[model samples]
Structures are given as structure tokens and as C-alpha cells.
Target: MRHPSPSSWAVISICIVAIVHLALGFSFGFSVDEAHYALYAQHLAWSYFDHPPLVGWIQWPLIALTTSEGVIRLIPEALWLISVSLVYRITLELHDVIQGRSSGYLTNVLPSGPSCGLMATLAVIAAPLPHVLSIGLLPDTLLTPLSLGLMLMALRWLRKERFSLGDWIITGVLLGLAGLSKYTAVFTVVALLMVFLSAKRKPWINQPGFWLAGIIACVLISPVFYWNWVNDWISFKYQIAHGAGGTWALRRVAAFIGIQIACFGPLMVVGVYFFLKQGWRNHRLTLLALLSFFFVPFTIFAALSGGGSLPHWTTPAWFCLAPFIGIGLAKAWSQQRRRLISSLFIVQIALCLIGFGFVLAGGPPSANLKANPMADLYGWQSAGQKAAELAHANNATGIAVQNWTLGSRAAWYAQPLPVYVLDQRQDQFDLWFGQLPLGANVILLNWSGLSYVPPTGKGAGFESCRLLDSLETRRFGQLLSTFDFSLCTNWRGADLVR
Candidate 1:
């Protein structure tokens, strides 16, 4: 048998990398967000109160086939496979072209470059954030492709001043699709536009095709806002609530940064290192422009918006710096530091795996529970299951949770038990549930509203059967640490003694 060359091995490695990504879903249970997205996909609305509808829309087809957690998650996992493939293709193209352009070497494919491509692809795959998130269906998965597609298209257009009619249409459609995936993707377009206009070396901003694409994207994405307007812009209000300190404190921001570092892994380290190392050089300007225009605006927006910021909000910024990191890594490997670089890659991947396990264990080792964040991953599923069990035990018609994010997850886990909210906010929990007749079949409550012994000294009309305590605990920096959730049952809750 003929032995495979290094090039052949790299190709096989890339395939293995893709498989590893797909295999990851099996290890993790569904998170609250995953459960929410899975349940929400069933409805197929034009838009949702919290997010645009694309994630739900994308996952709907798979979900129609099976409610299996792994099956529903596979859709995004497939997308991630495609994403890794795209990175491989993109990196190879850049390497071949850059080699010819900079060094006047006409090489068909660099043996070393594919390894670099694999590294970048693996960086994305094993980053711990997208990998974990991709394991659960969410808009971010859909956004990943759309966002990268937009960047790829922009790079192509930047390389070539003249945009063909086909390029214009495809770019426009993808940008609009990306926006549909997540509203945050709008910032991506801003970054792309800046790249085009500021390309003084090869300016293409004055072209009608460019503006045409921009207009088409706007026209396509406008319907989301129009739908929001028709619904009193609840989505807008939700965004505002999320952005404007609804859950603000100094500690959350710091935690967000720390999570991001873990999420991006070695890739983030190289990207940050490159920025500082190559500051203000001509080649670095592209990255600097991208960082300044996109990350700066988005960061300020996130800090100010304050409703409830998640670390993923800053994911796009890290993306802008990835290509630069790729270039830096290539330089490092070429300069005979391959062993050192390889060691770092191995170490980074190991840390990420350890962290991923920590999350899956339901809490971190540092925490009191020693359960990893991944444990919280399925607490909602468990909570919902518990609700169903109680309903089955009591021979009740249904069981419901107090109004919160858990309502959807619990109702979803509870299945045949319809999940209902008394009202949007907490103060009305009693008013809403109290209105229900005495001897209510089942009601589930979370840590906050359930544990409350009202100042007026009334229980929320639910007798506690169990706390459904979180086996996992998560600390989002020092600002806020959320207990996963527990089910508090009210067998014969109360009267609307108002």
C-alpha cells in the first residue's frame, strides 16, 4: 500500500476535524437557548419578540423530522461543517495568491499552507463557543455562514474593483439573509462598506453595483422591522431593554471579556497579539480599520445597551481579527518556529476541551457545585421533564411555570402540558395564577419568584414539592451569577385575595 503524503494527511485531518465538530453535539445536552429555539421553531412566525426568525426558520425543517435533541442540533452542526470547508477553501486561495503576489512563487498548493488552513478551521471548530453553541440550534449558527459569506464576498470584491452582476446579486442576498439571522449582523455590513470605500489602493466605492447591493440588502431586511412595527415593535423594546442597563453592572463586562477569551482560544491570542505587534503598518491597516469601525461601534453599543449583554454579542469583532491571525501564524511557522507554534495549538485545544467538559459537568470546579456550565445546558429539559412527571403523577391536565425564559423551556420539556404565562412581568405572577381556580393542577416556579415569601406574607399559591436545584452553577464574572433553575410545585396554590 502506498503511504499518504503530508498533504494527503492534512486533507484527512481536515475531514477528521469536521467529523469531530459534528460528533460534539452528542456530548452536550440542550441548553435553555437550544430548547427555546427548538420549541419556537414550531410556530414559524415572521419575527420573534427577542430575535429575528431565521434561526427558528432554519431549524424548522430538521425539527419537523424529529424532536430528538441530537437531530435538531445537527442542522447547525452541518452548517459548521460547511463553514470549516469554506475556511479551508478561503485560506488556500489566500495563501496561493499571497505567495505569488508577495514572493513571486507559483506554487500549486503549499504543503505547509493546508496545515495552516486546518489550524484556522480547527480554531473555529474547537473554539469552545461556536462548537458548543453549534451543538444547539440557534441564530448564531445561521449567522456564522451568512456573516462569513458577506466577508468572503467583500474580500473578493476588494481584490477585484469591478463587481459582476452575479456578484452584486449574491452579495446583496447573503447580506440581507445574514441580517435576518441576527440583527447584530447589520454591523457586519458597516464593516464591509468601510472596507470597500477606504480601499484607496483599489477604490470601488463609487461603483453603482456596490450601492445596488446595499439597497437590495436594506429592502430585503426591512420587512423584519415592518413586522415589528405592526406588533408595536416589541422586538425593538426587547433590544432596548437588553442594551440599556436592564441588567447592568461593572462586573458583567469583565466577565464578558473573560468568556470571549475562552471562546476564541489560541486564535484570539494570535489575533490580539498580531494587532499589537503589527500596529499601524500598511498591511495591518486593514485589520485596524475592521476593528475600529466594527468592534468599536458594537462594543460601545453593547456597553450602553445594557439590557442583558451576552459574550456572544462580541463574536463578530473577533472574526475581523481572524485573517490577521492566520497571516501571523503563517509567518511564525515559516520562520522555523513550527514546533513552538504547534505546542501552543495543542495546549489551547486541550484547555478548550477541559473547559468544555467543565461546562458539561453542570458547573465549574471553582464553583461550589463543581458542576459545569454544560450541566445547565439541559436543566431546562430536566425541569420540563419534571413538570411532565408531576402532571402525570397527579393525573392533572397540565403544569405551567411562572413567567420567565424558563416558561418556554419548561413548557417545551413538559410537552402535552401547555406552558402559559400569567403576565409578562413578575409582580403580576400572583394576579395571573391567582385568577386560576382553586386546587390548580400544577404550577412550576423558578428560584426567584418561587422562593419569594411575599412581604405581605403570601406564597405564590404553589406548594413546594421540589426545588429542582441546579446541578450546575455559572458565574458570569462577579456581576451576576445565575442559578440554573428548579421546579417549585404549587399543588393548591392560592386565591386572588386582591
Candidate 2:
């Protein structure tokens, strides 16, 4: 029997992955970030407090048509598919470039470009975080494809002696889109510059195309700049303080490295080692160019990990290295290391499935609701519905959450009725529904995991409060969390803390 073509295999892999993501999307409730970003669409703006507008802009149309969680999730799923395809194309391009420069035992033994592309695409599928991103749209999901597109265009531009006008324009547009996607896109822009500068044949600095690309990128990202300007640059100030605010610790750095390895999966981790070893030996310039993409963001984030950076912040960097890792995996396959490859895939796939199950099961049942990390993804939908009903029955004007984190789901799940964060913190919620108005009756939602005591009396925000309902969230008959809904009347308003 003849084997399937590499392109055919890639299609099959993408389809299978999409089906799984679709199921997972339907199975889970909105994650804290997912709900938060989804709320972005409901309240349209140039940009948001914590992220740019692209994540919201991309979903605006679909959300207008329907608010189904699974349907809304299709946007990210489509973006993930595009990212996978781009990685394949990038691997093929890099493989061809490297092959042209060499002739010997290594070149002869290496798998074909198409095969390498397939392997790289599979490497992405084997990873866990990408799947989570697929289940819900995040800024990183948007950046992944935009970043890959910039890398591919950069590689093509580097291959030629003179830069093409079209390539420059495309790069500029992608950079702008990437900027709209996430602030981390600046790393991609820097990486592209490093690629051009580090190459043996330097790109002409005075070229009109280069300047045009810069202009285009600036034009595209003008909204973000304008928004920041209007908001007194609060977003920029917050990010700088957030990224570097934590105290440095040795264990934090070690934990960050461990998380990266686990998130990338053992197969891709090994692939990275092989990629660096082989690229440095044969294609030093190419290696440096690629490293520019990975190392800058990875190193900065790793260092900031000591300052409490999130794990997914390094995802785009890992994605930049995907093509080279694919090459490494392809070479291993050519050497008939089938057992090793099969074992790694099995382990990763199993882990991915187990993760999905954990989410589906609403995390492990525990007496302490805060101990279950997955509790966030479990009770929000039901709580939102319960809050809405209670508000209607009691003639409450809106729903109020003590923490900003709880506002997204309450606002999203209980639409048309505004959800307010009672806290004084300046967040996206503040930008949306501001503080609950004076003398307004509101249903205050309190989740056991992050519960807050309702303020009452003459000096407090409310005059008096009474328990409206208590909701117990369960999965397979196992209790996961409890949400308390309190009816609070006569808001007096408190002093703004920030």
C-alpha cells in the first residue's frame, strides 16, 4: 500500500485536532481570560485596559450574529488552523534553504521538506497550551499566526539580494495586525530587524520599501497609541509595573524553565536541542536569525518569571522555533527512530486528553474551593444564569462582583443586565460599566473561591443586604464550588481606592 502525501497527512491532522477542540469548546465554560476578552466584543472600543482591540474586533461580527460559546470559539479554532499551516510552510521554506547550502551524508539522510513540514505541524498539535488557546480566543492566539506570517515573509525577503516592495508591505501590515493582537508583537518586529541586520548580505537601510513598511505598521497600530494617549498611558504603565514588579527569586526562574519544557512537550523539547545543535553547526546565520525570534522574548519572560510572568507569555516565541524543531524531528524519523517518536506522541496525546477530562470534570472535588484551579471554568455559566433570574425576580437593576476577575462571566453570562465590579481597581470592567450607581439595588455575586463580604450600613456602598440564593456547582455529582447571591439595596458609593 502507498503512503499518504505529506500535505494529505497535514490536512488529516488539522481536521482531527479541530474536531477535538470543537468538542472541548462546547464542553467547557468560559475561562476567566476567555470571558474577559469575549466581553471586549460586547463593548466595542479602540483598545482595552489589559490588551489591544484585535481580539475583540475579530469576534465582533460573529458575536453580533450569535453568542453561542462553541460558535464564538470557532474564530480561535480557525486562527489555530491558519497558524498550523503557516508553521508547515515556514518549515518547508527553511528546509529548502538549508538543503541548498549543503551536500553530504547529513543532507542525503534528512527527510524531504514536505515531511519536515508535516512533523513540525504535528509538533504543534502535540502541545497542550495551543489546544487550550483553540478552545478560547486569547491575544496570544491572534499573535501566533501573525508572528508566523512575519517570520515566513522575513525568510523570503532574506533569500533575495534586494528587498521586495510587496514583501515589505506585507511585513508591515502583519506587524500592525500583530501589534493589535498583543503588545508582545514588538518582539517579532525586533526579530525581523535582527534577521536583516545579522544576515551576510545586509538589507539596504535607505530603501523606500523599508520606510514604507514602518509607516504602514505605525498606521495600523495608531489606535493602540491613541487609546493609550487618551487614557494617560495607563495600559503601558500597568504592563511595565506588572512585568517587573515581583521580587526576584532563584526558584521562580527554575519553575519557569520547567513549565516551558512541560508546555512544549518532551518531543518538541528534544527537537529544540537537535535544532540548535544542527543549525549552529551548519547554518549559523539562519540559526541566529531564528534565535532572535525565540531568545529575546523567552529570555525576557524567563527573567520576568522571577517577577511572576504567566506561562503562556512565551508561547509565541516557542512557535517561532517550531519550524526548526520540525526539521529536527524529521531527521530523527529519517533515522528510523519510530519507537521513540511514537512513545513521545502517545504520552503527549494522553496528557492532552487527560487535561480535557480534568476541565470537563470541573477539577478535583475538594473541601476548599480555592484549591481547585479548574473551578474558574466551571460555575460561571450557572452563576450568571442564577444571578440574572434573581435580579429579575427582585427588581434588581444589575449584578455586582467584588473582584474584577468575576465581572467578565457575570457580565457575559448575564447579558443586557450590566455587571459591575464593586472594587475600586481600574480595570476593563471599570471602562465598561463603571461602579454600581448610587441608590441602585444590585445582586452581588460572591464565589466561594474568591468570596467577599458585602459592605452595608451608612458608610458602606449598600444600605442593607440579604442572601437571595446559594448555588452549588457540581460535576458528575461531585461538588466543585458554591456561589452566593446577595440582594443589596441603596448603594451609597465608596471612595475610589485607586
TM per prediction: 0.77, 0.94
- Residue-wise C-alpha lDDT for candidate 1, range 331-404, written one tens digit per residue: 55565867866776787778767765555454554643222334355445555665677567666546554444
Candidate 2: which pairs clash? none
Question: Which residue window of length 10 is worst by lDDT in model 1?
Answer: 448-457
lDDT of model 1 at position 201: 67
> How well does candidate 2 score on lDDT at residue 187?
87
Query: Which runs in model 2 stand beyond 4 Å of their true positions?
Result: 101-109, 365-368, 495-498
lDDT of 2 by residue, 119-171 (tens): 89888999988888877899999998998899898778766767789878998
Model 2 score (lDDT) = 0.85
Per-candidate RMSD vs. true structure?
6.3, 2.4
lDDT of 2 at 292: 79
Candidate 1 residue runs with Cα over 4 Å from true position: 1-11, 93-115, 200-208, 246-255, 275-287, 290-298, 301-308, 356-372, 378-386, 389-397, 421-441, 445-498
